[model samples]
Target: MAPPQASSIPGRLLKALQSINSSAPRLIASPTAVGSNANPGASRRASVAIIIRLRPEDSPPGGNAASPTSSAAASASTSPFAQALPLPGSPTVAAAAAATSEVSASDKAAYPPAQKDVKQQLERFFEQDWVKRPGTTAEILFIKRATRATDKWSGHVAYPGGRHEPDDEDSRYTAMRETWEEVGLDLAEDDYLSVGALDDREITTSLGKRLLMILSPHVFLYTSPETPVPELQESEVASAHWIPIDLLTAPAARYDSVSVDISTRLAPKNAFARAALKLLVGGMQFKCILLPNEPIATGALPSPQAVVPNAPLKLWGLTLGMTLDLLSSMSLPTDAAASKGSTKSGDLSTYPHAVAALPQDKGALFAPSMASIFPRFSYPDINALIWIFGFRYRRTLKQSPTDSARVNWAGMSIGSYYAAVRRALVVAVVLRALTALGGLGWLGWTLRKRLQSRRTARALAL
Candidate 1:
């Protein structure tokens, strides 16, 4: 089907953002006790900004326009946002440069407070003449990281962010500081407003077998009349693009799979052992979105030479996880559709309205996502089988779609969505190991028999 109505997205997004209730949190990366002394700003936590902005129509929408900000410098005053605090510091050339590991009291209060009535402020923001024009598609910013020899995320499609610096007052400050340092866009400025926070994600390694760090994805809404022109940092960023939310939710965006080298995921560090693992598991098939390089605003290299024009941009892994959380936050569920008759006419109305603007990956997830915390072996089809079994098992058990499964980022732990898949994984591994042992045992027995026969002069041979 064609992409969802673009103009209505802001309205839907506003509702989605306003509806977010932080009292009850979703299970992110891994669980941290609600009342525990665990700090979100711990050294392991890193932050990324999911910045959403309106590419305002060049003209005005006289009919739907809302009242304008009264300040003489409309874009200079305090902007409104989610109840959660936005980074509070006045940014200058020095602050952005130093990015010291410490945030002082003055540093924390550097920027103005964001308007807290998200519902009201956002409704007004979207109603502005420029934003209400026809075909006003919302866009999210994404950056390609500059390739570095030691950077694990080198040359990857990711949001702008970095780890919490010792000087950062909180996780939000780290995201703000990094965004400024990496892309030259300051979150503290009036040009943007905070959209609030997403669930904390626990980044992991070895197929979620080890906790690498905690990831906080902070969403922001751009309120400017003009498209954000980022001054790309040649050292940290390769190119910056404004991807329309419409393209992200389109059917074709998620139709393909990415081949990942997961052989090293759970293998020992020894070169021989890793190579042996690769031999056993040729490659892994995981989900990915074919992100277009359209509307590339700026880059380190000239547009043509900046990105391999021919090769498609692939988005997966931790970045994909954060993207999924953002999409989930934007959706509100609908009544499960059903048709009850011999005619068997399926009712399309039962399909989720919430998913209209969201990519629908066929999985046990309540919303579309990359599907697994672990990669699937394409040749052995171990991962694919897990998904298939999980789907069928859930159906057999008569589980509700609203209660679709969730995943843990920290390690191999999973929610109900992968319940059957987990069992299938154990069964498959055990059977494969047993088969290998049985073959080796039979070979050993045959070799012993031949050796014995040779030692004793066979009657016929004499």
Candidate 2:
């Protein structure tokens, strides 16, 4: 028989494939996919919205919790972590007194005795560990995460929030639910007034890849005169504190030269290898703020060594950015110029002078408006190549000559050298073309002159 027609074979194969496909199970979409289809905006919803309450002028300062006669004393005495000390004559008290005496002597030697004012401040911090009500400023709430070896954010300072759950009506509800779950501060809409929301910022990996989570910070003011203390939810939150907004605005709050490790691989033990690795994967530097300290639970151990003590609660990264946004919304200066002359060494005494001396020329300090916190650049995609090449050239020129690895041709950096060589080649090409054109013009002139002379000679001969 003749070979089976290819068309007939394809039809048979197609029929068999169709039958198999019809029997196959249909793929189901995930909950997230379904949710996105139902509400497209849910994908852009913020994972967290931290509340910022404006503290009243009469509110107690941070250390007011430590004073027995202070308004915070009532709350402090009722805290679950608070306990009565042993009687003075008891064996427990005597032994503890002796141990304290020994430690005090050693501490005095290691650290000079604080000045009278400083000593008073330290005493206040010990007495009142929580933010007290009736204050002249605003207080920003922060949460210390529960320690877990497996979690990347374990034991880190963060605002109370979590990923959006299906049960939540929206992101705001998600924030409220998480806050209540994490800190047991039942924040109902009637309990607090909504101040506003900050811009949404994307969460990213160490290498800057976008994650599914986004942060939307929502500010709120407690309606009641007194600031309520938060009950800790030990599973997710170790402690929560309300930090005074004034302290945050103070110049002493800012700390520079804070180094952050961003290496993806384990740091090399060898010195040379470590240096090479550092060059390959550089660390990020940030301006961090020291947040007010929270009262440590009785018998609780100190925080992890990685936790920087620049502030009682260190605020950095996205939290700091959001804090700045909050400040800007209040018409307060968010730029470093506001903190001018307010060096890390400056104390609270300098606040009045610094505030009074704020630079008259606000334009010199930062962008004229809060909306311009970060400058925006608009350019067409068609010019992207040119812009990128120009940027590379400028960056190369700014690099140190000692960084030989960055240097390409001779002493010039790669980009600059490449651009220079390209320019030279272009110039040479243009010169060559001009010279050829000049030669042709000269030849044409000579030929015309010779022909004229020949014509004249021929005419004379005739």
Candidate 3:
């Protein structure tokens, strides 16, 4: 199926933001919004900036390509993309007009229009000549953190953010400060407008029982597409990527699993331990999406554009949770239940097909990510056992979505309520350990039998 036109993105996005206030449960998460009570043992607050911009088709940052703000001369000239829009008499517009025309004037008068209810303006926005002028694609900024021994999220694909600092005035400032320090974007400047904040999130250790920090994701839009290229800070950031929205929504771009090394967290100090653990565990599976690394230049950091491997980057863990919320807002109205159950908030009615295009899990309960869930082993039996254990836990969360659980993504809760998910991992590890010991015992028995036979042969010969 054809992807949704990038032309319609701005309207849909605006519509989604407009509905945040009316949501039944009030999932308005602002970066500056006062921090709510912390979860037990979770005192830290962190914020990330989700910076979005429109990448005009085939136009460079400073390219002379025509823009929405360009002279009237450009709009007067015909553009190729304009032809595909629903023209006045076309069936789509006609159907829409027919639908709205049927709405009685009395009914229209009784209920004032909201951004969500103004389907006609949204339609008109799409119909504008400039919108269809082979215009821009929406893209969000992401950064690959430099490998740091101290950072647990080192080398992970993430939005720009850091833990709230004492000098910072609020969580929003933490995001703004870290963004300028890590990437070169000055979000506080006039070039960007703060759209709104996503619902707050919880950072937790694996098993989802422990709380680390509360995460607030703030959204910002570029006032102009000609915003300057990002300058990477070498000490914290390696490269910056502007990921296209189309890729994020594509069902094909979603992967069922990613391979994570088991030794990174468990056996960092001893090579022998690492090798033994890896030999047994190999690589475990987690939910992930494929992302290409297109790194931009960095003047702030000397030769700071770190060389990325040819492999596509994986988007999982807490970052994935934030992304899922962004994707859900695309279909927020269709599911008011989301507003009530979700801690988050999207306007995807402009493109119905992409709404709820939530990435699905194949075998594991990869409901976005809370903390890094322990991965399932390569052994199918072990994985099946793990899933079976999590079955009740997953079912409970599914039923009680509005239970104030701190972890949710794509309309699903993950951590804090995933004790069973963690317990399953512990069970799998114990089983693997027993199986390894059983195999060693059989090998030892076989060798002892062979040695006895060899001695018998020598004695017979004597």
TM for candidate 1 is 0.68
Ranking by lDDT: 1, 3, 2
- Candidate 2 lDDT, tens digit per residue, 1-462? 222122221122222222211221111111232443564234434445466554445565442342112223223344322332211110011221132232222111212211243223222322232223223344567877777776667766688877655545444455666676565555554555433333344454442332444455544445454666665556666666777655554322433334565333235356665564444434434445566666422112335775555346666655665565454333322344454543432221121112221233422232111111111112122123233444544454355322324312111332242353245334544655687799999999999999999999999999
RMSD of each: 10.3, 28.2, 13.9
Better model by TM-score: candidate 1 vs candidate 2: 1
Best by the lDDT measure = 1
Q: How high is the CA lDDT of each candidate model?
A: 0.54, 0.42, 0.53
Error of 3 at 19 (Å): 3.6
Stretches of candidate 2 off by over 4 Å are 1-46, 54-59, 62-135, 250-252, 265-276, 296-311, 332-462
lDDT at position 349, candidate 3 = 16
For model 2, the local distance difference test gives 0.42
Question: How does candidate 3 score on lDDT?
Answer: 0.53
Q: Of the candidates shown, which would achieve the greatest TM-score relative to the real structure? A: 1
Could you tell me which 10 consecutive residues in candidate 1 have the lowest summed lDDT?
345-354
